[model samples]
Target: MIYHGIRLKAKAGVTQEQIEETLESMRNQGRAIPAVKSFVVGRDFGGDFDCGAVFVIEDLDGYGEYLTHPAHAHTDRVGMPLVEKFDSYDITDDDDPQMGAKIADLHRRRYQSDPELAALVSKQP
Candidate 1:
């Protein structure tokens, strides 16, 4: 399995609610894409990071499809108005379970330095 993490910083003055709504819309539309196995979206309210979304896809081909898919294009169109800066990472490992745990740990460590993110980490299951 492959994981795609998209970190988004909302444009100045954009509300968290708007970001959530856009993400939800993307989730709704992303369902049609066969390559995407799972999707999760989260918003960061108190730090430099504002919002982010994660996609679990079958392979690099799926990632490519996601970039060119119509739903994705629509998502980009909608999201562009709300995003200031966006970055993405492609993650993979031989073991899916281990990879997931590692990803969580990575996020935990990345966020641990920031008090706001540390609080967010404490809230995760």
Candidate 2:
């Protein structure tokens, strides 16, 4: 299984509610897509981006199908207006489901000493 994470910040003046609504819509629409094994979306309280979404797909082909899904296209077209900029990450280790978390924790610990990161987290709303 492959895990994909999308980090995004909402456009100026966009509310958290709208961001969550858009995420909920994606989750609802994913019900029909066979490649989506799991989906999660939310704000990252102490992270770099304002909000993010995660999707668990079986493989590259599955991820490709997800990206091309009509529902996904529609959501990107419509919802992107509310997004400022987004970054993506994909992690896979064949069968280890815990790889994503381990990798994230490794990065977190590595960067924990950066004063700028502390400032960024402290400045969050």
Evaluated with lDDT, which candidate comes out highest?
Answer: 2
- Cα lDDT of model 2 by residue, 24-109, tens digit: 76775467568899888776666657877788888656766676567765555556667677676887867666666655654465
Residue 84 C-alpha lDDT in model 2:
70
Name the runs in model 2 displaced over 4 angstroms.
95-125
| TM accuracy, model 2 | 0.66
Per-candidate TM equals 0.64, 0.66
Q: How far is candidate 2 from the true structure (C-alpha RMSD, Å)?
A: 10.2
Model 2 lDDT, full chain set: 0.68
User: For residues 17-113, what per-residue lDDT tens digits would candidate 1 score against the true structure?
Assistant: 7887788767865587788899887775665677777788876556666655777656666676676776767688556656656555544554464
